[model samples]
Target: MHELAIADSIVQIADRHANGRRVTKVQLKVGHLRQVVPSALAFSFELVAQGTSVEGAELEMEEVPVTGSCRGCGVESRLKEFPLQCRACGSDDLRVLEGEELFVESLEMEEV
Candidate 1:
């Protein structure tokens, strides 16, 4: 699954930032459009974390909803399904505001 790749990236980031410190927790911000499975990501994290400072580290994820701004009426809409359209103007011309992000927000670490 792609979660394995994502988890590997996360581990690499945490390890780089940890600077030889033991990672305690990783605060992750995942967007809805990423389509990432939490269970799979958690499992992958644990597996990728082995033999690293991030081993045994807790993974906390925050979900970000898909938000788009309609260019027709200049209105913002929270799109939940396909065929993303503006709620107010019913326009399909929209620009994404958020919900495509996947990044490590913060890392809690202890001195090794």
Candidate 2:
């Protein structure tokens, strides 16, 4: 799965920020639309972080729900599925306001 690559990238980021220090934690913001498996990502992180500054670091994932705004009724609502129709107006004309995100939010580190 892509989680391995994603985990590698996270390790790289944490390692860079750690600057030879030990990483204690890494927090990430992941959106529902991204379809990332949190458990898989955590397992991959452990594997990828071996021998790196981020080794043994706890990975904290915050899941973001999908949100959309309707162009027809100017209503915003949370979306549960794709081909998203606005929940309030049931309009097919919509713009996504959130979801489809994957990023590192913060890092906790210890001095060497």
Strongest candidate by lDDT: 1
The alpha-carbon lDDT assigned to residue 107 of candidate 1 equals 95
- Tens digit of per-residue lDDT, candidate 1, span 1-112: 9999999999999999999899999999999899999999999999999999999999999999889999899999997787788999899999999999999999999865
Write model 2 residue lDDT over 37-85, tens digit each, in one string: 8899999999999999899999999999889888999999897677678
Q: In model 2, which range of ten residues has the least summed lDDT?
A: 80-89
Which pairs of residues collide in candidate 1?
A: none
lDDT of each: 0.95, 0.91
TM-score of each: 0.93, 0.91
> Which number leads on TM-score?
1
Clashes of 2: 0
Error of 1 at 33 (Å): 0.6
- Misplaced by over 4 Å in model 1 are none
